[model samples]
Target: MELADRVESLTPSTTLAITSKAKALKEDGHDVIGLGAGEPDFNTPEYILDAAKNAMDQGLTKYTPSGGLPELKDAIIDKFKRDQSLVFNRNEIIVTIGAKHALFTLFQVLLNRGDEVIVPVPYWVSYPEQIKLAEGQPVYVKGSEDNNFKITPEQLEESITDQTKAIIINSPSNPTGVLYTKDELEALGEIAIKHNLWIVSDEIYEKLIYGNDNHQSIAEISEELKNHTIIINGVSKSHSMTGWRIGYAAGNETIIKAMTNLASHSTSNPTSISQHAAIAAYTNSEEEIERMKEAFEERLNKLYDWMMEIPNLSCVKPQGAFYLFPNVSKIVNQSPFDSVDEWVKQLLEEEKVAIVPGSGFGSEDNVRLSYATSLDQLEEAAKRIKKFVEKYSV
Candidate 1:
């Protein structure tokens, strides 16, 4: 039997592929250092874990509302108001399995066949694929490295068409880790309002920013924009609760209801325990989140400095998130390797180092290195990378 056409048209996630390869090597006794997956190295905080246990003790294991638990929805509303100065009714918010699930549901609920979703390049790997799965086209707007890998308003406007329904904005972005400033969001927001297009803002990495940088949600730029924007976020990245699988969307009540209806039939409800755990995550885990951010910052600063010291690898120093995306084009040009993918392969085979190549992220010259691992692991990975590059740079 033939597979579904939609499934055939999709590409597998390169990030997961590299991560699985690393895991397989480790299983075979190879000392592989995996810097591919975006997960935080930290574990879920004890408080949140305890909350999950407390939920069970309280007999909350029964299925919650498919949209989410009312208590969890209330916490999300408070979170938006507390962090973004945005207000939402329970009708406008829905808890999802994770931010990835939230986005997947939104795309399905919003897009019609052939409708286009504008995606900024060097984006998170899932955005385009999800759009395609929804039978919508992905229109790319370049976030060139010169602009700190952020798209300009002019560029965004130029990509719109009669079929354009929405634009996906992520900051601090995955792969690039660059945070879009308030001014930038306002500019983009103006364009979205001009064209009446939805702005699907992915703020999953909002709480993980470094230094003086802060994440500005597009929906908060103006009242008009807020009406036209849907904010997607979750506890996975922020609270180190990746395994707990709790995420949410805040937007127009009609759209949220539609997404919730879809979830009702597909996945029923997010886990009852996860919803309660997320309540604790949003309401009580501020200190724990800050602590994880500090560890990531320390690792980022040292690893960034080391990567800069390497001769042929150039990268925009990421402002947030635990990943460092280095442009290894120069190294590739000097070496005999035909592409960054090939170079990554050689490094993995020779030094047992694994990194996601840029081609997977719509970029062919760069490689993303997540600093989520410990400093000791990061240091050894760096040493291995340097040795690998030096061998071919000559």
Candidate 2:
């Protein structure tokens, strides 16, 4: 039987692909250091886990309001008010299975066939695929590496057409870890407003920022911008709650209602116990979160320095998040390999170090290395990578 066209065209996620290969090799007793994982190495905090246990003990395992538990929505509302100073009523929010699901549902409800969504290049692996799944066309706007992999307002302005319905903005981006400054956001928001386009702001990594960089939502810049933007966020990265699968979208009531209605026939609601745990995640003290951020910062600093010492490699210093995207085209050109994907493959086979090739992320010259693992492992991975580069690059 032939698969559906939508399913047929979808490329498997390269992040998951590389991670799975590393796991398989490890199972065979190969000493594989997988730097491809995008999750925090730390376990979910004790307080959040305690809340889940309490929730189960209270028999809070039944279905909830299709949108979310009221209290959970209130908690999310409070979080917005606290963090970004943005206000939203409960009806304007819809709890989703994850931030990914929130984006998928938004596109599903917002796009008809052939509608175009402006996607900045070097985006997360899922964005283009998700857009295609919703029968929407993804129009790519390249974010040049010299600009810290961020697209300029002129570029965004030039990319829009009447068919352009929305644009996605992921700060502290998945592969690059680049944060958009407030000024940059305002410029982009101005263009978005001019074009009357919806802004899908993915801030899932907001809490993982490093150094002095602060995260500012475009929606928070103005009431006008807020009216047109939907913020996608969750506790997955912030609270190390990836397994909980609880995320939310906050914005206009009409869109939220549509997402909720679609979800009613689909996921129904996020798992009840996980909802309770997410409440704890937002309400409780963030000391544990701060500690995790500190660890990631240290790892990033050391790994970045080590990576730079390797000949013919270059990278922009990331301001937030836990991943480093390094351009390896120079070394690849000098080496026996013809492409970054081949170099990545042979690096894994010879040195047992796994990293995701940037071809999957729409940039051919770079590869993404996650610093979400142990310092020792990152150090070792750096060594192995340097050794491989030295061996091959004449």
Which 10-residue window in model 2 sums to the lowest lDDT?
Answer: 208-217
TM-score of 1: 0.99
Tens-digit lDDT track for model 2 on 27-122?
Answer: 999999999988888999999999999999999999999899999999999999999999999999999998989999999999999999999999
Superposed Cα deviation of residue 188, candidate 2 (Å): 0.8
Clashing pairs for predicted structure model 2, backbone only: none
Per-model TM values vs. the true structure: 0.99, 0.99
Over the stretch 1-394, how does candidate 1's per-residue lDDT look in tens digits? 8999999999888888888888888999999999986899899999998999999999999988999999999999999899989999999999999999999999999999999999998988899999999999999887889899899999998899999999999999998999888998999889988999999999999999999878888888788999999999999999999998899999999999999999999999999999999999888849989999999999999999888888877889988888898999999999999999999988888999999998888999889999999899999999999988899885
Query: Which stretches in model 2 have alpha-carbon errors above 4 Å?
Result: none
Native-to-model Cα distance after best TM-score fit, residue 249 in candidate 1, in Å: 0.6
Candidate 1 runs further than 4 Å off = none
